[model samples]
Target: MNREERIRSLLDRIRSASLDAHGFVTELELQDFRKNLLVQRGVGMSLLMASECVVQLEAFSPDFVAEHPEIPWAMIRGMRNRMAHGYFDIDLNYVFQTAKHEVPDLVRIVETLLHIHPQGE
Candidate 1:
C-alpha cells in the first residue's frame, strides 16, 4: 500500500477502536476502568489507538499540517507524546472525555482527509 493508503488504514483502525470503546462504555463494561482508573480500559485503549493514528499520519505525511492548516498538528503530537510517555500519570477522566467528545471530531477530520486524498495502490 501507498502512504496515503497506509494512513487511511490507520485512521480506519483508530475509528474502529474508538467505536469499540464507545460500545464498551455504552454497555457499562468498564467497572474496572471506573474503579481502578478514573476512566475505563476501553477508553484508554481508544486514546492509544487515536494517538497511534496521529503518529502514523505524521509519519506518512509530515506536511499534512501544512496541507491542512486547519488541523492541530502540534496539539495532536503533544497528546501522542503524553499518551506515550506519561502512561502512569494519565488522567482517566480526560481520556474518557476525549473519547466521548474529541474522537468524533478526529474521525470527521480523518474522513475528510481520506476523501480529499484518495488512497491508491
Candidate 2:
C-alpha cells in the first residue's frame, strides 16, 4: 500500500491492539502477565504488534513525527526496537505499563492526527 494507506492500516492495527489491552488492569495484568506463560506470550505479542504499528507511523517521514510534538514518537519507536531485538530479555513490567496506559494514549494521539490530517497532509 501507499504511504497514506499504509499509515491508515497501521493506525487501525494500533487501535485494535490498544482496545484489546483494555481487558487488563495494571496490577492484575502485571501479575497475570508475569505468572502465566500463556498470558505472558499473548500480552507480549500484542505489545509487540502495537509497538510495530507505532514504528510504522514513523515511516511517513520525520516531518510527520515532528509535527506532533505532543506524541512520544521516539519513545514509542524505542520501545518497539528494544522489544523486537531483546525479545528474550523483555521487561514484563514495561509490557504491562504499555498495555495499561501507553497504547490507549498512542491510539488517541494517532486518531487525532488522522482526524486533523485525513490525507496525512
Candidate 3:
C-alpha cells in the first residue's frame, strides 16, 4: 500500500481500538475498572493498539502527522512506549480516564481525518 493507504489503515485501526476501549467502560466506575482485571486488561490492550497505530502513522511520514496538529501524537507515542517498556508500572487511573474520556474524543477526530484525507487524493 502507498503512504496515504497506510495512513488510512492506521487511522481506522486507531478508531476501532479507541471505540473498543470506550465501549469497555461505557457505564463503568473508576473503582469498578480498578477492581476488574479483565476490564482493565481490555482497556489497556485497546489503548496500546491505538497507540501502536499512532506510532506507525508517525513512521509513515512525520510531515503528514504534523499536518494534523489536533491529535496528541506525542502523548500517544509516550503511552505506547510506556506500555511496551513497562506494562506493569502503568497507573490504572490514567488508563481509566483515557478510556473513559480521551478515547471517545479520539474516535471522533479519527473519523474526521478519515473523511478529510481519503485513500487517494
Candidate 4:
C-alpha cells in the first residue's frame, strides 16, 4: 500500500486496539481480562501495535507535523521510543492512562489528516 493507505491502516489498528482495551475500566471487563493471560497479552499487544503505527508514520511521512501541526508528533514519537526501548520499564498506570486519554485523540487527528490528504486513497 501507499504511505497514506499505510497511515490509515495504522490508525484503524489503533482504533481496533483501543476498542479491545475498553474493558480495563469496568470491573466485570477487568475481571474477564485478568482471568486469562491471553487477554492481558492482547491488551498489551494493542499498545505495542499503536506504538508501532505511530513510529511507522513518523518514519515514512516527512511532513507529518507540517501537515498537521496540531498533533504532537514529538510526544507520539517519544512514547513510541519508550515503548520500544524501555519496554521493561513501562508502567502499567501510564499505559492505562495513555490508552484512555491519548489514543482517542490520536485516532481523531489521524482520521482528520487522512480526510484532508489528497493521497489518502
TM-score of each: 0.72, 0.77, 0.94, 0.67
Please rank every candidate by TM-score, starting with the best.
3, 2, 1, 4
Put the candidates in lDDT order, highest first: 3, 2, 1, 4
Residue 95 Cα positional deviation in candidate 1, in Å, after optimal superposition: 0.8
Relative to the true structure, how large is the alpha-carbon lDDT of every model? Answer: 0.67, 0.73, 0.91, 0.63
Residue lDDT tens for model 1, 1-121:
7656676787677667767656555544334446754346557766677667767777777775467766666676777688788878877666666666676677677677667766552
- Number of the top-ranking candidate, with lDDT as the measure: 3
Which one is best on TM-score?
Answer: 3
Q: Which digits, one per residue and each the tens of the lDDT, describe model 4 over residues 1-121? A: 8766776776666566655554443343434544666655555677777666666766777575467677676776777677778767766566666665666677676567556654523
lDDT of 2 by residue, 9-119 (tens): 777787777666644544564666678776666667776787787777777566666767887777777887887899899888888887777767777876886676576
Residue 18 CA displacement from its true place in model 4, Å? 3.8
lDDT of 2 at 68: 71
Relative to the true structure, candidate 1 reaches a TM of 0.72
Clashing pairs in 4: none
| Runs off by more than 4 Å, candidate 3 | 118-121
Model 2: how far residue 90 lies from native, Å: 1.2
